[model samples]
Target: MARSLVDLLTTHAAHQPERTAYRYLATGDCDGEVQELSYARLATRSRAVAAWLQERGLAGSRAMLLYPPGPEFISGYLGCLSAGVVAVPGVPPQGRSQNHRALTRMKRLIADSDAKVILGGHEVIAALGRLAEHLPELDGITCVATEDIPDEMAAAWREPDLTADSVAFLQYTSGSTSAPRGVVVTHGNLLDNQRVITERMGHTPDVIAGCGGELFVSWLPVYHDMGLIGPVLNTLYLGVTATLFSPLHFLQRPDRWLTAISRYRPHTSGGPNFAYELALKHAKPALLDSLDLSSWKVAFNGAEPVRAATLRRFTETFAPAGFRGEALYPCYGLAEATLMVTGGTVGVPPVLLEPETGAADAAAVGCGRPGEGVTVVIADPEGPRELPEGEIGEIWVRSASVAKGYWRNTLATRESFRATLPGHEGRFLRTGDLGFLRDGELFVTGRLKDLMVVDGRNHYPQDLELSAETCHPALRPGCTAAFSVDRGIEGERPVLIAELAPEAVGESEKITDLIRAAIGDAHGLSVHDVVLVHPGTIPKTSSGKIQRGASRAAYLDGTLAPVGATAVR
Candidate 1:
């Protein structure tokens, strides 16, 4: 296995040092102008960064990379690995008002590692610098600009040898409010997962992928798991060429993702269900008519719930643009597993199934079976028994590819690695997701633990959505949301958010009550907060999972005032 990320770049540099590894697709008058780096160029830059860190007596220490998506991100990451300093990626605070809290998490992570150096672009460097001005723990900050690589930096001496088992980088992920956990990713973990991905996805060593080139565009936030480690790191692993655009670029014009796909003819790319839906909602007819997706081979769909209807409608709409239904690959993964856990067989069509059906119902949409080197089990929470093919169970995965543990939190690490295999020989990673194995294929259900339990029975929010639209013409089917707030020992009470159709904007609460009655009758659950918002008012993450966690946080902080509730806080 390749020891470090630098090794991946170095090997590629040796094979095709002159080939374009990354391309920055511009938006201004320089729209056509591309900023690219050959493997040689990247290695040269990395060496400079390593030497700079060494000169500051911060070599072998941990540092944070807080820059936005660009070649600088690539350089900042690889430079730390090359220098033997642990690399920690910085995440932008989601709650604008809670920026300092986000910084506190970053600060805690850095302090835990005893890291003193921070590497970033002007913006992140500036923000952290200001934070450092008050927090005495933070040390020197280095702005590694792609355009300003000094001559001395280019010729600086390389650092010590890195190994397969050596710690490469630390990836931060969401946890309880009290503590932040970082997934400690090693060089071995990266190399193993990359091999699995490259072999399954069919990226040849000789392939010259365009940087989001030949036909496609992506506006996924570079900070996201799928965005950062999935695409950017995967590109380096297989040596594919791709275009880089900030996640905001797509938010501004989601059509750009399609426009870029149609324009670039990219062989592989895709995001969550919401992205495809957004493109359909935002893109003009003329633009859709002019685009084409036929050249795209692997449109990976995972990270969040993969809705069958969403995939079906997308292929039906984009058919005119040469989008083939067979290119959809519905997969499952999380950062804890180093990215992908189980993916739909690449180059296979997605398996279609009714969302209302739990694992007990089996259907196929051409999403092929699982790959070798991975084992998937559907286990009931009451005990360690595999459910029948059609039974819904918490999806537990055991793989040599699983990550080591969360950094600095051994308790969480132990809890995260409990396995369900017979005799309990080893441990498995609990995904907290629900899915079923059918006809040797996998169909994902909603979260196993996210179900809303009222009285004594269990109810899925999706089922409420699928049934509610029939009761009221104004309510958008499948757009309805149901969640619960803690009510102590009595369990949790339900709340619903249903988006009104464009025509039914006038009728909100009456339609809400009707739908609420329908849901109450069907599921025997009471939805106290029947929020009636516009079609797109509900926020979603880049990968398309409704950020239930973020939404709850918003509601608690008073940013979101549902139909009728006391002001939060």
Candidate 2:
């Protein structure tokens, strides 16, 4: 076992210096212009970066990494680890002054992390310089383009003194529920979670050998935990080759994802549930006919709710292309747990619970059992007592893979990371998620804070959202937000905001009526108001998770513009 990622990179460089470590596609097309990096070159570039940081006496400081999708981000990240600097990965500003959302996020991360320096590509650094006047957070920080550092600097690199408990990086939350906070992850947490992923996904030597050696195809953003720890870092952990591309490219043409899988024949690859839905939206007969996915064994889905309909539809749609139903692996994880907490067996189809009475499509999919050395328990959110099986409660986790806590936020750390149960010996991470275990399989229900109680009945927002989305074709899938707003003496009012499809028009009243009827019939609760909005109007996190809290805030402040007159009960 390697002590740190630096050790793994060093060993791989010495043993297989010429082996291609990564290949980046500029256009997200299999036949597009591509760039490849060998182990030796990556090692040299990483060392150069490490030496540069060391020379600047930044061994114990935080360095923000803001780079476009490419190998440069990987090298810069590894260099931070090699130099013992805490790496803070964030999305770079796209040089558009109107992108205030991205700029505001960057500013927030910089302020929260108090990063001493910023490492990025040459172009990214120049773009930051152009916007430096508007960003006071970069006033005293040093900005360096790691690409400009001389390879000769590698000779001056000194191996950082590190251990299992040493803080490696700060992974900021996606803020799907609330304000983003940096989760403090250690080297041990990273390695242990990688081990958990390997074991849970069955990334064994035999599996790799059977699939024609270890290989991966990914377009997930490297800055996100699901992308960074799951695919990219796991590739390095296994010392395998991963073909990379930009997330934007993948979004522009969903066919590229399947095409990459066909070309690379990777043993394991996946993304959030929304990615599969996007692929389904564009699965033309011609594209499906060209795909050969027999070598794609594990398609793990996580980072958000995994809809049973999505799993079934995706499997049936792509089965003609040799995509196996068993390959649709549904798992569960969060940033505070490093990445993965529980995952189904590699060759098993997802387990779906029996649907509630009169609601056949309301079955929840299981997120698999916990990995080795990890314990998951359901406990009441307001107390220390554990909940019985088949009862939904807060998901509490204890494992080596769990992060230390939130960075520089002791109050949150104690509140979220210092949880305890009646007989549990160690602290457990309060995941703020609601789920239940049935027959040892975890079935996530909904977010704890997003739960709504109206007329003395508890309701999960996702259930209402799902009902509304399936009510009409005009309602976009995965674009509905269900939240509760305080109505003074009227108690909590349920509000549903859904985006219309691009081609959907002039039926806002009809669509809103259908959604209300569907919710009333399915959940037996009348919606307080149904607001139909234009496409892409609903707020979503960078990872595509619906932001119910943000949506509620916007609704309360009248910031969300309705497509038509809202229907109020």
Candidate 3:
């Protein structure tokens, strides 16, 4: 058995040197320009990078990886692991010089992680040098273009001492509900989670053999946990082939995803719920007719709320293309747990519960059962008692896959990662997500911090947002934010902020009225106020989850600019 990911790569390279490990699509289309890296070549490149880092005596230090979506990022990341360096994966600066927002985010990550080196593509490294004068964050940090390293450097590579408890990487949170914090994940945590994923998703030898070997296709951002651990590293874990494309490409043309799936016929491929919705939006009859997704046995969905409507629509729309409803897998996970905590059984349809009274949607989809060796318990967020099945509470997790804690933030690490239940032994990770377990299955409800308590009734913001978005065609899907504002002694009042389509700017009043009525009818709650802003104004995390707290702040400070007229109730 491989002791670490580095060992796994070395073994694969030795046994199957010519096997393709990864394929990159420059344009996200099947026929577009492509790049392939075999196991042997990838191992050589990784060794080269590891030797360079070792020569600089940077072992045990943090190295920030800032490369665009490509196979190079994988090499840089694996190189860090081989060198016994803690890797910090982050988004690279884009555009001509450097985007201010992107630069600011980069600075925060650099300072937070205290990364000593920055490994990026040649172009990104060159741009960083040009702007070094203005960026104080690069004052003492070393920047290297890993692509420029010679393969001969592999001869000088020396294996560093590694252990299961060794820190592997710091995965920063998406900052949807709060500021991002780096989650400290060790080698043991990583390997255990990979096992959990494999067991829960049924990535067994029989399944792979039936599908002609393991394969995955994804366009998720590499900097994010879902993209990195789920599809990318899983490929390496199973010694399978994975075709990757830029997230920007998928956003530009959602149909490219289906095109690649039809062309490659991979056994597993999927993204967040929004991804399925986007694909459905562009599923023209001609496009659907030309695709064959019969080989896709696992269409895993997570990272965001999995909607029953999306699952039903995507299956119905792609049924002509051989997509199965049983392939629609709904799972739940987070950065704190090193990625997957719970996932649906493979080849099974997602379970949906009947709508509760005053529910926003017709049904709630179950996230799925916990992975092997993972213990999930629902506990009251305000108390120490664990809730029984079918009762909503904070989702607490205890597993080997749970990460060590937050990096360099002892207070946060203690507060979030050291929770104790009355009867459960050992520490449990406080997921900060509210959910309930029914029949041994997990059903995520909403973020504990984002849950709105109006008139002593618990209201999930996602439910309210869903109701508001469906009220008007002008309202953007997955772009609505529902939050509660404190109104002194009057208690918490619900507020809705939605992004309006450009052409619907003049219909703010009508849209606002419709949203108010829709939410009131479904959730039985009157809107305190409705603010319709320009498209893309609502705050969202990198993974596309709505930042309800940020929206609430903007609304309170009067920073949300109205597109037409704000409706005050």
Candidate 3 per-residue C-alpha lDDT over 1-569 given as tens digits, one digit per residue, 9 for 90 to 100: 77788889999999999998999999898898999999999999999999999999999999999998899999999999999999999888897434776787788999888999999999899989999999999999999999899999998999878888999999999881225599999988889999998898888888877766647889999999999998998989988889899998999999999999888878889999889988988999999889999989889999888887778888889999999999989999999999999889888898989786634245889988999899999999999999999999999999999999999899999999999988889999999999999999999999998889999999999889888887887787788999998878989999999989898877788888899899999989988999989877887887888888888888888888998666453
Counting clashing residue pairs in each candidate, in order, gives 28, 0, 0
1 against 2, candidate with superior lDDT: 2
Clashes of 2: 0
CA deviation > 4 Å runs, candidate 3? 96-98, 176-179, 357-361, 567-569
How far off is residue 187 in model 1, in Å?
A: 0.8
RMSD of each: 4.2, 1.5, 1.7
Write one digit per residue (lDDT tens) for candidate 1, span 1-569: 56667777879878888877777765511246667877788887777777777677665567877666677877777778777777887754444644765666666766665566667776765665556668666654444543355547857757557777778777766442335577887777777777666665655543334333232235555655677666777778766666667666675677777766666667777777557766766657897777777777778876655555667778878888888888887777777777776666655676666435442122233334555676777788667777888787887777666778888788888866665556545688877777778877776667765677777677766666655655776665446666777767757777666667767756666777787798787677776656766675555533345655555566556566444322322
lDDT of 3: 0.90
Each prediction's TM-score versus the true structure: 0.85, 0.98, 0.97
| Candidate 2 wrong stretches, greater than 4 Å | 95-98, 176-179, 358-360, 567-569
TM-score of candidate 2 versus the correct structure, residues matched by position: 0.98
lDDT of 2 by residue, 395-473 (tens): 9999999999999999999999999899889999999999999999999989998999997788999989998988887
Clashing pairs in 2: none
Candidate 3: residue 195 Cα off by (Å): 0.6
